[model samples]
Target: MPVHQRPFLALGLRLGAALAMSSLYMLVKLVHQMGVSLPEIIFWRQAGALPLLLGWILLRGQMWQLKTTRFKSHATRSLMGMVGMLANFGATILLPLAVATILGFTTPMFAVVLSALFLREKPGRWRGLAVALGFAGVLVIARPGAMPISPIGALVGLASGFMVAVVSIQLRDMGRTETPLSVVFYFSLVGTVLMLPTLPFTMTHHTPLQWAMILAMGSIGTLAQLLLTAALRYGPVSTVVVMDYSSLIWTTLYGWLVFHQMPPASTWLGAPLVVAAGLVIVWRERVRARAAATPPEESAPAGRVPRGR
Candidate 1:
């Protein structure tokens, strides 16, 4: 493909991926509003998704490619991913879609901070400033005065953020040892297993319509990850990172259309901060890329800790 065409393809793929993910959130919120507990919603949604992924493996004739040498890494990553997605979905149910979406993008910031602390990677001055500013913005979004905080909702978002950071860490380690698709596929499988123990408590009253919604959630989620993976394949990581931010736009629309709910003012104020955090990461990444474009002055670090992809 031509260079110009590549970006256009990426744009379209990101847009579609955004729509799928935002729609999954919207649907989960709808189900929760209809009286499903968070546990029940998570169990059914992920369980429904498993067979669809199985179908994809069969269709692609790549079932053999599902073999993974990094089972423990995938298992750990999947557990964290499960926690992240459940909390994320629950947050969507309790809060405005836009607010949830905006705060959720803080994943990258959390990724940076966690990487620095755990991976012992140092951030340059500008990136450090960006991380601090982003956390202040999180405070703005979580203010006690306006829109009294829901502890469950807040915890959901924060915990999910941390788990997602862990997911990125595992990905970094495992990406070298396994295929990306294999990693993603296994994450979904492990997530379904992690979500299973709750089934007895989760198996509650559900109308047929609700079941359909849950299944749709699973299908959409699988589709969303596929498109996102494809989008990454098509262009620069920075472009895909920027496009990931567009989920807020889709979630905002979905929130209003589905539930007539609008995010609070503080969330609106914090949106720029979240975006700025991602932009900072992207900028730092570009700087690193340019450095890599040059011959190194000395020996390079081994498996250098990366900014959240």
Candidate 2:
């Protein structure tokens, strides 16, 4: 079946991805509190997911598809993605779940600017306004002068968002030739390899429960990645991307229930603006896609009017 035929399924998958991601963050915080180092956390995240991904690839008889000619591209993407993951996890450790989640929402805004600069894709008026509004929302949430949260956490979260935007741009080019599974597999593999040397310094003793939580965190992270990939495969970008905002709900609930933390008043005030900006960007992209797909009308012959005229 064609992917665009399953918009509702795509939506459900995207929502599931959001939930999984929120759960992963919560678990990361839990394990970190148990004395897990950042490098160990990152290593477990990638190492644990690698086997699951491998099993899925083999079970689907798609191992051959993992072969790629763009080794350098994969390496670059994996490195950037690992940095983004580290920053995101680090932010989760330093900040409340809801605040970290809100900061991560800046990705689309960054993507708008990055796209214009690197991809040479013009943003036009509406998208330009959207980018401005998104940044304004970020300032409202951060509230620099009267900041109550960790400034470092806020900066790290924003860095995560920027790296994610850069990775998104890289994916745009890679997607032309790479399979999603291969992209994911290589990312996991490379991430694990990159984090291996740190094990000697970062690894610590863990109880069975801590070990279980670490594994669970990695498993949930893999699930989120798979769900996100599947969502995009089954739906148009406009339909799927909007569902990313649903993470705000999941993260908020997790923060309140699991961590006993609530978003500040500024989060309540600024979240809507960021969300609205992202939606506006998605809406514009959908409109542009539709326009591009439309065939141009035939011009009237010479000076003669055509048809009803």
Candidate 3:
């Protein structure tokens, strides 16, 4: 099947990625609450995932494909990715899971705008409307005028969302020439190396359970990253990323079940608008794909019968 025809598959991968990422965020929150510093958490999240990523590459016998002329791109992506991770993790620590997750939904809005600006993927009228609706839903949920979140946390969360959009555009470009495994592997490797310098300052002894949770963060995170990269590889950035709004469901569940924190009534009120926006994009993409795939009928000469008729 053509790549453009796989929106359903991309949607599934994106939804799975969302679930895995929300779980990772929950773990990050738990570990941070248990006294792990942000730098230490970042280190473990990347470092722990590196070996697993390497093993996956080796298992697929694609180690040789890791070589690329795009190291500069990889470096830029890695740096942006690390900054995004820090802001995302820090937000998770500072805010409620639902709030952080809702804030992250801004990624799709940014992705749509950046895709138009950088990737040159036009946001048609439907997509533009969907992004606008999604943003309105986010405002309803965030309720800046009434919410009690720290201003710094809100800024960091927004930064994370913007960086995520930037990285998604980078990945869309990179995916053209690099295999998904190569992109993910290099990110883990570079992230691990870059974060190593902070170990001396941030490392601390952890109980065995804490260590297990840290490792789990890495494992889940690696899976989420791979799924996300593959989804972008298989679909348009704006279409695939809008699916990330699904993460709010998983994050809300984690917040309720694990942290015993219920989202405000505003969340219930606003979430459907966000979800509806995603559905609009998905429906529009499918329609567009079908229209592209269907060949136009040939016109007959004037006063002449068509060949078959």
Candidate 4:
């Protein structure tokens, strides 16, 4: 419970969460390779998480907290989340895991732009520069003229990040009044319901092993979200956000081990730019937060000004 230890605990939790999420992405690719359609895979994913979320709400006696004052906001947020999920799944099917994972790191970059546009939260010089660098990194990985990987897949991954950014803005607005559990519960519920129709036609019979992998993928996803949330709750976002980049390591390992695919030179070269950009954004935000937390000289009451002045 010590203040100093929280950062260490948060870092570990974020690392674990990143590993679990990387595993989930790899599982999605596995199921896609197994011939399941995207809709059905998405349906199962949402369905799998639904139970865990609902159980938590019920067990915590927090069902009353699930009530939402902003149904429209929840619906909008869920819609954006579903689209992001679709794009993410598509990227996994189309691109190598490591490449897709790295591209997804652009979420923070896109979030800065979107926050300015929608939330009117303007980024300072450092974040603006970081966003620019992030886009340049995307260009390096994408390489439109002399494509290293599937260009379409790379674009889809970037699009997914943008969609997630949009959804984050919505969540930020809703979080003003909504409980965290309510936001997650509604998103899971909505995503499941939205993808339900495809289940009947797209669901194919699978072996017991395949079924287990599918379910495990969904369960691991739920666990990943829980760990990520807990990490943010315990430590500053800057500390925890940096740990998310560890997904690149996990995904690269998973790619090599499971699919015998290693990232090309471009990924190795470009990923650092993107990761660095994201870290800059986090650092800038941390500086701003600390600045806000400290009182200005003029705000000091009476002659209480320190001798440092």
Candidate 5:
């Protein structure tokens, strides 16, 4: 209730939620480092998530709320999500989870540009600068200037960012017609379907412990998303976003301590700028949302009509 500390407190919540999600990413990287194949990783993790997601909805007795009038759009969204997952996982293997996430946060920046170009939504000036800055940050981390680069990790990051943006835009349009539960069900359904083709290709030699880790990856992601949704019900989004900064800290620590994988100093320097780009995008979007929600100022006509004529 203290006014002065509100920003501080809100920051904590978002950071905490972000950290929770980051831990999931860390687990993925660690498991993958143990030499698990991407398809196998995705299969176990996403499959593990499905039952828990359904169970939670069932607990709320909202399972029947699922619908599918926009099957095409739902399928598109899910495909985009699957691609994003692939790129993201590959990035995790190529770089530290924290570094990949910093690169991944470019999603919001991509969303801004994609929304402008495709949806005809005009973003503010700051978002434009953020996009450029984000690219620069990528250059810093990728070392395009001084050394040979595979471009695979960078490409994967960009691809994941792009696909996620498409999915987000799809959701924006899809939201006008689809119920949240319906959309969620479709995402799970389509993702499962798309993932099926790759299932036969996945490494099937995971030990029980690796399977457990994979299961944890999927389960925790679903739970974290749910918890984050719950957390927002109790607190403001700005607080939650700021709290997400904690993910950076947790992921960085997890990547360093557990993996002993450290990035070049240039990467460490650029990461803050990358993260700042995400924060700025989130802040700008929140401000825009608030402005849009505020009713336009009303003015009496030059000549007022009689009331209830």
Candidate 6:
């Protein structure tokens, strides 16, 4: 089947993936609160996923999928991804879940600008407008003087989104030649290696319950990433990404239930605007994709019959 043909199914998968990710972040925040350092969390997170990913490749007899000429590119992508993930997790730990998640929504806006700069894909007027409106929503959420949210936390969150956007660019470049499995495996591998040295200092003794939560966080996060990758492979990023907004819903619900923290009025006010802008951007993308897929009009000389005629 054509990749874009079953977008609704892809949408479901993306939404599910987002929910899983939201849950994972909540767990990460819980463990961090329990005195786990970021490096240790990242190490176990990457390490936990390694076995499942490798097992999948083995079971599917797709070990050759690991072969690639793009090792350098993969390393670069992994480095960016690790930094982005850490920043995002840090924001999650430092800020209220809802606020951090709203800031994370800025990724699409950053992706629009980055695609124009790095990939030479110009976002047309509609998308440009969407980016502006999205940033406006960000400004509303981040009205720094009032101090409803920490300026530093907000900045870190936005930086995380920006770094994730950079990773997206590298993923796009890598997607041209590499399998998604290969890309994910290398990311986990490199991320694990990068976090390993710090693990000595970062590690701490844990109770059985704490250990279980840590393992669960890593397993869920890894599966969520795989689901997200598959969702995009089966659908356009525009379509799949719209479903990611549902993460806010998951985070909001979980934040209240688990942490007893409700989002302030500003978050409620700003988040929908950002989401609306993102949806508009997605609509524009779909229109553009359809236009690109369409054949241009063809005409015959006035005196001649058309082939179908």
Top candidate on lDDT is 2
Itemize residue pairs with steric clashes in candidate 3: none
Local distance difference test, each candidate: 0.73, 0.84, 0.82, 0.82, 0.69, 0.83
Tell me how many clashing residue pairs each candidate has.
Answer: 0, 0, 0, 0, 7, 0
- The TM-score of candidate 1 is 0.84
> Which pairs clash inside model 1?
none
Ranking by TM-score: 2, 6, 4, 1, 3, 5
The residue-by-residue lDDT of candidate 3 on 13-115, one tens digit each, is 8889999999999999999989999999998898888789778778988787687989999999999999999999988987789888877767766766776
Q: How far is candidate 6 from the true structure (C-alpha RMSD, Å)?
A: 5.0
Better of 1 and 3 by TM-score: 1
Q: Kindly report which residue stretches of model 4 are placed more than 4 angstroms away from their true locations once superposed.
A: 1-12, 55-62, 119-122, 172-179, 232-239, 298-309
lDDT of 3: 0.82
True-structure RMSD, every candidate: 5.3, 4.4, 5.4, 4.8, 7.1, 5.0
lDDT of 5 by residue, 1-309 (tens): 112224444454445557667878788888887888777777666667678778878899876667557778878777777787788788877776667767776777787787788888877578877777878888887887575334677788778767756665565466556655566556666777667788777766778888788878987766554444344434444335445556667877887899886666777777877778878877777776565676555323446642310
Error of 3 at 232 (Å): 2.0
lDDT of 1 at 97: 83
Q: 7, model 4: CA deviation in Å? A: 5.6
Which lDDT value does model 2 have at 37?
88
Task: Give Cα distance to truth, residue 212, candidate 1, Å.
Answer: 1.6
Model 4 scores a TM of 0.85
Give the worst 10-residue stretch by lDDT in candidate 1. 1-10
Candidate 6 Cα outliers beyond 4 Å, as residue runs: 1-6, 59-61, 119-122, 298-309
Q: Which scores higher on TM-score, 2 or 6? A: 2
In candidate 3, stretches whose alpha carbon ends up further than 4 angstroms from where it belongs are 1-8, 115-129, 281-309
TM-score of each: 0.84, 0.89, 0.83, 0.85, 0.78, 0.89
For candidate 5, the per-residue lDDT at 288 reads 67
